[model samples]
Target: MTRHKLGFWILTALVVGNMVGSGIFMLPRSLSEAASPAGVILAWLATGLGVLMLALVFGSLAVRKPELSGGPQIYAKELFREGSHGSRLAGFMSTWGYWVGNIAGFVAVITTFASYLSTFFPVLTSDKVWVDTGILTLKAGNVLTFIVCSLLLWGTHAICMKGMNGAGRLNFIATATKVVGFALFIIIALFAFQKSNIGPFLAPRTNDSGETLSLLSQVNAAAVGTLWAFIGVESAMVFAARARRKQDIRRATIAGLLISIVLYVGISILTMGLLTQHQLMASQNPLVDGITAVIGPIGGKLLAALGLISLLGSTIGWVLLSAEVPFQAAKLGVFLPSFSKENGKGMPKTSLWISNAVGQVLLLSTISGSISAAFDFIIYIATLAYLVPYLIASLYHIKLIWTGETFTTRKERVTEGMIAGLAALYSLWVIIAGTADLKTFLLGIVLIVSGILFYPLLFKKGKVRGTSN
Candidate 1:
């Protein structure tokens, strides 16, 4: 099969689309409860910087080894395979992490879409709505969740099935709409903010021990929770081989990342400034709340619709990248050979179908829960898997610099490598900070075990030769 024919616009969309998803629509309120408005802004800024660094590192690696198949996985495998001291197991784990992170990204978008719909329609947000039998007590806003999420999934698939051209066009519109939506949200919130709502910007409250604690802790928590907004900065690196110009990969990723940073930080600050900690914490969809408060009901609904579209775009782009990761890995002999198969559409049919199938399964299982709860669970587990690759990629950067092997411009190389190293450390820190429940952690272990068990099955029938598409 020929490699996917994505150009600069599609590549940029992938970066922007992947980074902008559900997080922008819902993260602000959750973050406001944890920290002050300033904390939320700082969190956005920090996450943006860390993730941008990741993109730069990945871009540098892609430029250096333009022919590699897997993203961070390829970099790690090459580092260890070419006589470096790194472990082959580390390379293997990195591949698994990247794959799992994409799955989490899927879950995040779907849940956020569901959360937004719940606002317009309300029964979907409650756990009891689904359990009470035949009461016909249709919650006013709940049905919208399932409807919107289904539409998003199918609509994205429809465009994607048309090939990369359709997806590229959709991505352009979706990315622009997403950024504008957030910008409008911020502008409205600022104009409508009430001085009363800004009360006690840093209030001191009594703790359980009758001691006072600063109100900013909540904002700190909010910042940490909202940090995942920047997680998809590596979107360009995954499909680097498909870009119009090899070097354009760095420019596209960096530009897209910076764009999202502006959107995320601006909206987050406005949201916190307009709503009290109690109001922000209690909000189901903070961005929507801020918009509704600033504009009118009509504006809120329009924003929700835009948010839904943005979520769909992110899902489509994420699914494409997620499916490609395994397919590319399989072609490189890092996964089962069956995954390398492609259909007449030039799609990695088997891989794409399997990835979609798994994502659907996740959606069905978690749709009944609180959107934020479901998101964190998926993200925490996925982060565990995704972090391994970041670390390996960062270490690879250090190795290259130490060996004095040139990749891109010397300035670019040094900057990319340093950023990669910092981002890697930050990724590890985030993973440690995430509080994954027992079920998710166990599920992760089971998946890892299954991967290890199936390793030899994929390698059977003699040595696998490198297959170039």
Candidate 2:
């Protein structure tokens, strides 16, 4: 049977939907807390260029190697090839890192979803309500939040199980809703913009004990905060196999990235202009808070509702992407074979369920913490996981350029090489920044090491097939 595939616009929406989720909703305050307004703008410009280069590299790979459709895993596997053991390890690690990142990302999505939902459903975000059953006690509000998150997770799984086309349509609607909602926000925010609120854009230095930071240092710090917003830029490449035209993958990736950048920078800048850095830092939901200050309480609620809808769409988009990575990798024997199994609708049933199961477990475990705390923990780890794949992919792109394997003209080659080099450097910087928190750094290391255990299973599978042959 012929399978239905996603077209250019739907693929673009997938990228946009996945990239614009929890990060943007919370990052305005985070960025303001980290740097001055000028520093924040510079950080966005730097991160934007870095991410755009990575996106372009992925798009170029889509065009140059259309048959390699599983994203980083395929890039590593093909570049390194079948005969090299180190190559196989690189391929497996790329796939594993991506899979881990997706699961962590999903947890962030659900936690953010519950957090926003709490604006309407107070119980989900309320302090833990203790319930005792003789010998045991449970946090009732936490348990309820867990149940809500689980239902959303599994419900999306069911939709995805039906087919990609159905999921894509749902994502398209969600993406459109969020984009329009944010556009309204930008328009309103601009009207509310106060010149004085920006306040000496570069921040003044006092002493070591003071809150002053150099512009360069501030930009560097802001880059780390903003990195999570762009985590799903590679979504189009991951689903390349399901694109109606291979060329659509390239177009969708670049277009989606540009759109996301504009929205991120515009909204964040306007948000800063509307609220003082001190006020923004104090705000739990900066966007909604800024809107409230301008329009009133009702406007805040409206934006909160819109934020929930946006997060819901993002969660759905990410679930599809998270499942696809391992499923596609398994098909190439880079992961356990079970992950490749699909239902009648051509969905990766086992992969989807397992990914959500992990996310569910993480969500339940973190229920004791505030939504912000849980989000911070999970997002940092997710950012760490994502950096591994990005770093490896950038390196592979550099290798291709060095080998003169990708471009036709000398100018194109030099330009592409420079871009790839800058992306590789950016990836390294982000990874270093992610590790600055020792606890998160150690936890990420442990997770990476744990993934190696599965390598033996793959090796065993290969040996059995060799004996059979």
Candidate 3:
């Protein structure tokens, strides 16, 4: 039987769904905490341009390197496929880094989902428990929340296991719901706009010595926080193999990216206008809070419902991507062979199960405490982890341009070269911004270094295959 493939619209939904996750919902508050209104706007403008360039680079690669599927991993593998051990290690690192990042992202998504659900079902947000076993005391609320998260994770897994077409259709529904919901939010915010709320737009905070931070420093500080809103801009390129028309991958990526930019900028700017920086910083769910302050409690609850829908869709999209990356890598002999196994529908059964299992472990480990704190920690690390693939892909684009591998004309080469250069520099800037916290920086380094252990196993598998063949 032939497998049903994903089409242009579904692919587009995947990009939009993955890019507009829980980050956008809470990012207004997060950004407000770090920068002034003017600084936040500057940060968005900068991040928007940089992420757009990266999206275009991915689109260019999809068009030019149609044979190289499986996202950035294939780029690393093919670029270094000269049989040197160092080259092989580089390829494996790209794949491993991407897989690890997605797993961490999955944890962050589900945790956010649980947190949003807590708005309605306060039990999920409760910290106290009836039982107190010394070794493994379980909070009733947390256990129930975990059950709900696990169900959503595996339930989406079941849909994806049916086929790409089915999964993509489900994603389209979820994406459409959230898009409409966010549109309503933008409308309400605009109607409730207050000019006074947006004043002191460049309010730079003072240090302990009473020295205010410079405008440039304030904008720089907001870059990483705003960059989170554009994390999955390359979702379409990752599933290139499943796309019915390869060109659709490029169109879908650019289209989805433009849509996300509009939504993100609109929501952030409008929410800033609706509430003062103090109000935004104090609230956990700033979108909901802004709506509530403007209209009433009903408006806030509606926005909360919308957030839940948005996060659920986003989580589903990432889960599919998380499985696809490793499955494709395993087929190319980078990951373990088990990951290559697929069900009758051509879905990566083993990879899906493994990815969700890891997510489950992370969810259980982190959900024991404050959900918000856990989410904040996971998202910061996940964001850092993602920078690796973004940087590698940008460099790969530069390499292609230098080798004239994808350039058709002098003008094309120069334009792409400039875009790739800017993208690489922007990725570096975000990575540096993410590393401002020394402890988080060290943790990221440790995670990257830990990928080394899997190399020996991959080498042993290669030798066995060589002998068998």
| TM-score of every candidate relative to the true structure | 0.85, 0.92, 0.93
Which ten-residue region of model 1 has the weakest summed lDDT?
82-91
lDDT of 2: 0.81
List the RMSD of every prediction in angstroms. 4.0, 3.2, 2.8
RMSD of 2: 3.2
Model 3 Cα lDDT, one tens digit per residue, 1-469: 2233778898989999998987787788778877888989999999999999999989988888766667665567555645556566776787887888788877777777777777788888666775787866778777877888888888877887888777778789989999898888888788899989876977876534567878787777788778878888888998887788888999999999998999999999999888887888776677877888888988888888988888878888999999988887776666667887899888899999998888888888544666666766777777787888788888889998898985779899999999999999999998988787688799888777788887787766344121100
Count clashing residue pairs in model 1.
12
Q: Write the per-residue lDDT of candidate 1 for residues 247-266, one digit (tens) a residue.
A: 77878788888888888777
Worst 10 residues of 2 by lDDT: 460-469
Model 2 clash tally, residue pairs: 0
Per-residue lDDT tens digits of candidate 2, residues 1-469?
Answer: 1133889999999999999998888888778777888888888888898899899888888887766666665566656655477666776777887788888887888777777777677776555657767764567667777888888898888888889888898899999999999988988888889989888877753323575767877776677778888989999999987888888988999999988988898899999887887888777678888888899989989999998888888989999999999887777666777887888888888999899888878887555666667777787777888888887778878887888885678888899889889988999988886686588789888777778988878776353121000
Which pairs clash (backbone N, Cα, C closer than 3 Å) in model 3?
none
- In model 3, where is the ten-residue run with the lowest total lDDT? 460-469
